[model samples]
Target: MEIMLTPAAKAGLDEWESNGNKKVIQRIHDLVESVQRTPFKGIGKPEPLK
Candidate 1:
């Protein structure tokens, strides 16, 4: 599965990085990788929308 960030999310990430939240940014990247590896299992609970 591919991960696509919304414009708002991209902007928020940019803002965070500019504010020196590298550790948080790294964690987010790690979470995204985890989700990509296992969409329905890992880190956080995966819930179906409908």
Candidate 2:
């Protein structure tokens, strides 16, 4: 699912990026990564290209 970052979320992300807050950025990255890894939204096992 495509995530639409809200204005506040965008600001937070931008701030973290600009501030070089690796911890906060890592948390955000982890959240997104976990979401993408889920089998939700009809996602199944990854398939190799034929």
Best by TM-score: 1
Error of 1 at 34 (Å): 0.8
What is the C-alpha local distance difference test score of each model? Answer: 0.87, 0.73
Q: For candidate 1, list the clashing residue pairs, or say none.
A: none
What is the per-residue lDDT of model 2 for residues 1-50, given as tens digits with 9 covering 90 to 100? 56678999899889989999899798878777766666353233444558
lDDT by residue for model 1 (12-48), tens: 8889888887789898888889999998886777786
**lDDT assessment of candidate 2:** 0.73
TM-score of each: 0.77, 0.60
Give candidate 1's root-mean-square deviation (CA, Å): 1.5
Residue 18 lDDT (model 1):
88
Candidate 2: which stretches are off by over 4 Å?
39-50
Q: Tell me the spans in candidate 1 whose CA falls farther than 4 Å from its real position.
A: none
